[model samples]
Target: TIAAEGGGGWKEYAGGYSDWANYQASVHQAASDKAKVDVRPAARPVAAAAKAKGDKLSWKEQRELEALPERIAALETEQGQLTTLLEDPAIYQRDAKAAQQAAERLAAIDDELMELLERWETLESRAANQG
Candidate 1:
């Protein structure tokens, strides 16, 4: 209720309102974390039974592992180029040399990320249990 100034009652006013919002958040804190949740889209591959998984590498895995040398060589080559560019005398000509340095760092991070990806692929292929 509001009284008008003309009435000389109180001259009260009300005109502020926040957004009316209803939100539901479901936070499922994993209990124990011992149970692995496979939420990814792909169905997990079943690894060989514990007994049958002798140290022998599968044909595909052997191929992938053999390819590691080439992949590592490429990653190392890219990293070396990135380092050389960062150290090159002409690269410091930019107005934001600091930013250039940061860019170089980002490049290094990208190279490392690639290396990690390669390693992960290799390891995934070599999984005793491909699950």
Candidate 2:
């Protein structure tokens, strides 16, 4: 039962390259997903160790931090007195002369406080570096 042109002699077949295409697609996907690894210079041990110890802090650091509170209090004490002096009507009116003198004294104390506070800040910075 063959056709006159021998059409039935050969089985009809599909010419497909789907398997190769699928394999190439998988290979390309794998290439895109490949992990990347890199190496870089390590940090300096001296500087890094210093920074790590600085982060942890220590007994000396605690004392230095405590001094900050004392410095802040001492520096601002004059502000409290100025507030009181400003409020007292007796000193502002009848005691204008005395108030002037007291004001001068308070200014001197303010200057001294500023100097001490600056010194304290410097010391604090040095202590921080020691870590």
Candidate 3:
């Protein structure tokens, strides 16, 4: 259906179409920008839990808990060393076996470190809850 009334109807339709397209584009852009943002709340440090009835950790338990950071740091240092070794171009090119071994060792260390961290957190949480 062609409306030929000085092309006013066609101009109005074109103008409306342009406005609608622009509005849709702006909405999509806004949504994309919002999606790019990290909307999750910032994590807070774990608060010390309230003391339980007649619950006290031993001195040894306290000492081990205190030493967690040091142990984690040591493991991190070892991990860094392994990472450096693995990254060496010479090792990758000249000694594939050694590189593979290093990668395996690194993975094992990572697993062990993750386990240790989990255990440490569990113990710490328990201690906090007991205190």
Q: Please give the lDDT score at residue 104 for candidate 2.
A: 53
| Model 3 residue 55 CA deviation in Å | 5.4
lDDT of the structure predicted as candidate 1: 0.46
Q: Per-residue lDDT for 105 in model 2?
A: 55
Tens digits of lDDT, candidate 3, 1-131: 12244645431212244544553465456556545773434222222332332336668668978898899999899999987875465675687678666766776677679767876877677788776
Regions of candidate 1 where Cα sits further than 4 Å from its true position: 1-54, 95-131
Question: What is candidate 3's CA lDDT for residue 112?
Answer: 70
Q: Which residue runs does candidate 3 get wrong by more than 4 Å?
A: 1-55
**What is the per-residue lDDT of model 2 for residues 5-96, given as tens digits with 9 covering 90 to 100?**
26545321112245334433543454343322212134256336646665445676567667766776864776677647744646645765
CA displacement after TM-score superposition, residue 8 of candidate 2 (Å): 99
Kindly list the per-residue Cα lDDT of model 1 for residues 33-104, writing each as its tens digit.
212453433323323332256545668656766777677667667666755654443444453355354444
Instruction: Estimate candidate 3's alpha-carbon lDDT, on a 0 to 1 scale.
Output: 0.62
Order of candidate numbers by TM-score, starting with the best: 3, 2, 1
Clashes by residue pair, model 1: none
Which 10 successive residues of model 2 have the least lDDT summed?
34-43
Candidate 3 TM-score to native: 0.54
TM-score of each: 0.38, 0.42, 0.54
lDDT for each candidate structure: 0.46, 0.53, 0.62
